[model samples]
Target: MGTTQLESVPEPKYWHLKTVLTEALDSEFSVGEILPNERDLAARFGVARATLRQALEQLELEGRLQRRRGVGTTVAPPRMGVSVGTEQHVWPGGPGDAWQSVDCTEAAPPAAVADILETGRDEPVHTVRRTRMSHGQPVAAELLYVPASSVPDLSAIDAPAGAAHARALLRELHRLELEGQDSAVELGSARADDAKELDRLPGAPVLVVTTRYVAGARTAALSVATYRADTCRLTFGDSGGVEIHHPHRHAS
Candidate 1:
């Protein structure tokens, strides 16, 4: 265990703790390395356990640490980046897409999802859970809802159904000229189920991307994708390599 007395700064103790811990994580830790127990860490930092825990919580939320029951906290690997864009819209199984369906079942859409799908509150929709991995890391988990009417030929799908079947259904459905798509991104916390899939604790910070696909004049499908935020920078529009200018800074 390494020890260095952190100088007392005017900032809040928790903030300072977070900074010191972050630097330590960057310099002395590798992904999946177990951190020293909180008691030892506090003793080394000369701070209270509560302060150390607060910093740890923030780091966990940012996908930097994993805290498991009976196991100590460990450093987390980088998150994956999944692009959300308006390019050629194709079926889920198309080449180059990073999503793979995990399971599919019939369920009533959540109230919010029902509203967006423009279906009755009790209407049953095919819910497909998909996990997207990039660079060998799990990045996003999605719940895709497809109305029965949109996929009338689902009976032909094979048993032991999963990504392959979901892909087939999507390919057939895409015959209906997907004309356009609209999307919205917002900050959200990972729900219990999603947290389990993403290997993080519940209420972890995430970027929720909701997309609606239109065929003709009607909404055909809806996809809600939750992405790990700390390791992603959601890019939009053309990939113009322009440098962003900061108005607050002036050249000396």
Candidate 2:
């Protein structure tokens, strides 16, 4: 006779709570119906506030819940499908671009951006800040980089500097033949500055979209954007459409 051993598996509490909350949302809660306060929910679940919040945050990110600062957490509608890979080789501000310019400054970009731009570490590049909105809610933040050489005609004495210069830089980019563009998306935590612009808490889950604009033999511009992954579903279609995804938590 032989004895067999069965090993027990461990699961995180927050993950478990997310599953339970998801079921409750499906069967018990209606869209826009406010849930119990965090303290009450935590007490009901016999977990710490942080743990309860972790589950709620995940649900919010999956577009299953929405949380307001003074208001309360409620069931959220389906996520919005924002285009990503539809027309690959075009400037962002061309059409159907929801981004609005904030301001522009000539400063050294982050080291990672400088590497992609292939510019000298100390060289000043035009950094244009922009924000994207959807359904009247702030959804994304972006930084566009353009080197001095890319737009030689952009004068040191441009009529206006901030957003005007930013728009001018984008307009000049149109003059150059867009040879190609490269972009990627990855999971990331929001930085403090971006969090403020995106109206999210610091270290919130985000989808970082990095793009490089190519002209002739040089990198004309680079765009680094952070999107609210919980509310946005990156889509790429000539005719944009919406789709809903329900994420399930299951054991391996």
User: Best-fitting candidate, measured by lDDT?
Assistant: 2
lDDT of 1 by residue, 203-226 (tens): 878899998888767778899988
| Model 1 misplacement above 4 A | 1-9, 69-71, 85-88, 133-138, 159-164, 230-232, 238-252
Candidate 2 regions off by >4 Å?
1-17, 23-33, 38-54, 156-159, 236-242, 245-252
Instruction: Estimate, for each residue in 1-252, the C-alpha lDDT of model 2 and write its tens digit.
Output: 999898887888999999998987777766667898889899998999999999998888787887867778977755767666666678857776778988889989888888888998889998889988866678889999999888888885465877777787788778889988877889999999988888889999999988888997889999998998777778776676666554332223
Q: Give the TM-score of candidate 2.
A: 0.78
RMSD of each: 9.0, 5.3
> lDDT of candidate 1?
0.77
What is the alpha-carbon RMSD of candidate 2 to the true structure? 5.3
- Which ten contiguous residues of candidate 2 have the minimum total lDDT? 243-252
Residue-level error in angstroms, candidate 1, position 203: 3.4
Q: What is the lDDT of residue 224 in candidate 1?
A: 90
Cα RMSD (Å) between model 1 and the true structure? 9.0
